[model samples]
Target chain A: MVERWPIVGMGAICSLGSTARETFDALCAGRSGLAPIRGFTTDWYTSDSLFEIDDRDDSKDRPGRATGFLLSVIAEALTDAGLSDDLGDVPVLVGTGLRELRSVELWRGSGAAVTPAELHFGAAVRSRFGAWDTHTFSNACSASLYALSLATDLLSAGEADTVVVAGTDSITESMFGVADRVQSIPPDAVRPFDRERRGTILGEGAAAVVLRREPGTGGSPRGWVRGVEVNCDAHHPTAPEAGSIAGAMRAAHQRAGVTPADIDLVMLHGTGTIANDLGEALAMREVYGEDLARPVCTAMKSMTGHTSGASGLHSLITALQSMDAGRVVPVPTLEKPIDEMSGFRLAREQAVPVDARLAQINAFGFGGINAVTVVEGNR
Target chain B: MSEQLFVTGIGVALPGADHRDAVLDPQVPEPVDPAARIGRKGLRYKDRATQLALVAAYEALRDAGLLSDPDDAKSHVAVDASSVAVIAASNYGNLDSVAATIDTIQQDRSTRLVSPINTPNLSSNVIASEAAIRYGLRGPNLTVCNGSTGGLDALRWAGSLLRAGRAEHVLVVAVEPDNDVVRSFAGTPRALDGAVAMVLGPARDEVDTKRPPQAVLSATQRAATIDDLLPRLGVDLTAVDGWYGPGGAAEHGLIGQVRPIELGHDWGTPSSVLGLLQCVHAAARFAAGATGTLLAVCGDPADGVYCGTLVEAPRQASRALTAAGHDAHR
Candidate 1:
């Protein structure tokens, strides 16, 4: 059987909240963080709505907004894990879609004196936290989950006692422009699985989880990462294929040593786009068939917006908090659910009370990269 | 440590080198177009890095006897399509595409004029995904854009996938293009414009009598420093037949006792392709009938260091040399 890695500490900063606890509470209360783009002028694009954090750190030493978010979340995670900020030899694996691309754009747009060394976060991470080593994965939206998979492998292979897996992305003009052009009319709010959903709004934030070989001395583990499986569709660049996604989900379940019946909750990668929602729904049907209603489903994007690369860990932290509170957060903006997800019991309108334990989180990215993670929450 | 991984095939698309035998050439040659080496039928939308990676992957697969033609849609391989994986490492693979998109947006003040073909190229994983799609490699595909240690980390990830039974064969490719954007990001006047690919798989007992592995990867480890990593491998570096590492290792006093063979000295400072280039050079040395083991160390001080030990395959060293088309005298 595959060994399970314990998630000892987690920290998240997104539109909903600045901390994981605050985000979970906002999610339960069905608060929406989507608003007009404040970080940059979105006058060039028709779609101005985005989930952006309000906290600003304009220090001269700060490389960029994305790096600031990443460092803040990592510090929170380390502190929550009862570890010193000076990570002696722990390997930090970061997943980012567009690392410092926004900073580059800013530099090019307005002669900002951003150094080339700030392009990659290795130097920033080393200087701030004194990390021993760092590696960054840019697997699109599913980047962090891939980092999580690698961290689990490190623990299973006895490579490290603890590994920090983080995902961060700030909305870039390039990506936002692409998203704006792709959709005929960009929607004001993210509405996952809704029939009227036009497209997903871009969001910015960072999320991190600390995985340990054993329970750390700081605190008990939030949950155990039972298994994670990653695969490629090799079909299309932006469009997702259902067959490969279903295969990844099955592989993750097999690795986790769990059956469809044991899962109590599922965090869908519901980007609310016509292609993404329909593809994810088709993949779920292929996995569960008639038993899809067994696990309560929720789409965190409706509240947190599409966090992109950080969405997987954002969903993961939300799932753990749901299990703790015995309530599944609702997809607040989900109304007139799509016909494809008719049989699935999606949490909508209000939070659902349940004794959830085993939960699965799905993160699909551009280039047909897909990652599925199964975690077992502590009761 | 990995469970006896083997290097079965090697391919390169370096500036000065065209074939595996010339990968370690000291003289720099004129720049060659990747589309010229590989066919240009489907190379219109692909960026330079992706094209280079595709060329290298095609050669590597053909070298491994898994593919016959790059244009053939039905080339047969020994393993299943779903059992092969692709892992790529590049720090600036998508720089050109991203810069083009951003520049277009900035110039037009809108995204309506952005080319649809170039939109997907903005994704960093597109290089690896394109390789997988071209070859129908459906297993775990990943792209490493980390700092200096990305190449070695890609190798480590391939080992993990193989040991965990996720893939029967893995095509590990590392490419860095020499473009203005790349050079700007690298903070150098000139940067490495090359790609290297190696097909790695588990070393099975029932090896084909006719074809043998080029080398056996005994172990790979990473640590803050060479001093902290050496004891973990439990191998005597002094006894190894060859040592390949960065030039900075000599200053750190890690390689004072041993003569380190530094590859890519003239290629400029490579970001993530240095480690894979080192491996390709070592494989060529092994195929040329070098004895004992060779160590390839890669990484910078900030990202730490990674060391991988490659031992010559004992029984099939002679046959492997013939299979790789290496001149035994060279």
Candidate 2:
């Protein structure tokens, strides 16, 4: 069996809340962060709705918004983990679909004085935390989970005792515009697994977790990451394949030395798109078959919006918090769920009470990149 | 836990290097035409970096005897397609595509003019995923866009995958295109317009018993500085014949008398592909009959340094030495 890494600390900044605890509480309360886009003018686009974080504190308005978000989240995670601000030789692994693309967009459009080096978080991370090494993964939406997998490998390979895995992304005009153009009609909000779901809305924020080989002085670890498996469909660029995703899920379970019956909760990569929901639902069926209802499924995007690369850690943090509270966060916007998920016990409307122990989080991205991570709660 | 990993094949889509032998030549040649090297059939919508990666990947696969024909879609390797993985490293793989899409949006004030077919390239993993899709490699595919240490990090991950029995063979490709979009961000005097690829597999593989290995990867490590890295290598530096890394290896007082062959100074600034280029050059030197141990290290003081040791395979070493003697006599 693979060695399990402990997640000692976690911090999340999203539309729902500015901290992981706040986000979890808000999720349990079934509060949605979806609102009309206020960062930019969506006059020419079909969708004006997005899950944008309120950055009212102008002091947080760094050159790169995403970098600022990441730094803040990292600080919180470090504080939570009882780590010093100076990381010494510790490595930082950051995952993002578009690293500072929004900053680049601003520079290109308005001729902002942002240098090319600012396009990535390397300089920013080094300057702020004095990390010795930083690795950035741009694996689309599944980026963070991939980073998490690499962090696990680093720990297992004796490369490092502790690794900080972070994922952050702000909505870029190009991505927002593409989403607006692709969706013929704009949906009111992100509705995962809903019968009338149109597509995912772009969200902005960051999430981070501190993983250590041994549980350090950070009280009790939030959860233990058993295994993380990443694979590609190699079939399509945008559309996800059920067989490939199912294969990844099975591989993850095998690596974790567990079976589908052992999983008590599942965090679905339900993007609310027609293809994504169907593809995920099909893969879930292939894995659990008739016993799909045993694992209580939940989709965090319905409340957090699609944070893109950060969604995986967002979902992971939510899962751990739910396990601690003995409740499954609901998809407040999911009403009249899709028929493909008919047999699955998808949490909806109200947080469901359960004795959740082990949870599986799914993060699928464009280019058919899929990452499945199985985590066991310490509670 | 360091298993026996061998460099079975080496390929380069470098400028002025038509064959693997010329990869180490200092003279810069004319720009490489990816269409001529590979094919133009799937060139549309692919950025220059992806195209270069394809050319290098094709050559590496063929060199490793994994592919019978580059044009044949049904060409199969002895191993299952699902058992092969592809790992690519690039800092700005999709910069051009992203710039174009954003430019179109800025000009038209909408994304209606952007081509949907090119949208997938916006994701950085597209470089590695496209290679997997083209070659039908269904195993774990990853693209490392980290800082300068990305290439060595890719190698480390490949080793981890192999040790864990996740993949039988891994195709590692590192590319950097010297285009306007890249130049704008690279801020380097010369950005490398090339791609380096190598096929890494277990030394005890059953399928290729007859083939002589290129070199055996002895160890790989990442540390905050050269001082921290040398002791971790676990290899005797006095017996090491050559070193391929930054210029300050001798100053570190660990490399002994071996003058470091700095790749960045010889070649252009390769950024993320620097570490892989170092390995490629070391492999070439080994293939040319240079004996003993060769070390390839890259990365900066800020991002830490990554180093790997390559040792000559026993059988290949004898053959290479004999060939070198024969060439010397002639």
Best by TM-score: 1
Q: Candidate 1 lDDT, tens digit per residue, B1-330?
A: 334567777788888886677875645666757768876777788888898898888878877767745355334355687789899998878877777777888788888888776877887888999888778888888888776767777887888788667788999999988888777656788777888898887553366755567667654566667666555445565555656665423344345365666564477667788877877777777667766666666766544445444444444442222221111001
Q: Candidate 2 recovers what fraction of true contacts?
A: 0.47
**Residue range B98-180, candidate 2, lDDT tens digits:** 77878887688776887777777777778888888787788878887766777877887788778667788999999988877
Please write out the lDDT profile of model 2 over residues A216-326, one tens digit for every residue: 864889899999998888887789999999999999998899999999999998999999999999999999986798999999899888999899999898889889989
Name the docking class for model 2. Answer: acceptable
Model 1 interface RMSD over true interface Cα atoms? 5.5
Where does candidate 1 stray beyond 4 Å? Answer: A57-63, A114-117, A217-219, B1-3, B26-28, B68-78, B204-206, B226-229, B247-254, B262-265, B301-330
After TM-score superposition, the amount by which residue B51's alpha carbon in candidate 1 deviates from its true location, in angstroms, is: 0.5
lDDT of each: 0.79, 0.79
Q: Count backbone clashes in candidate 2.
A: 0
- Candidate 1 chain A: 10-residue stretch with minimal lDDT: A54-63
CA error at residue A204 for candidate 2, angstroms: 1.7
Clashing pairs in 1: none
TM-score of 1: 0.92
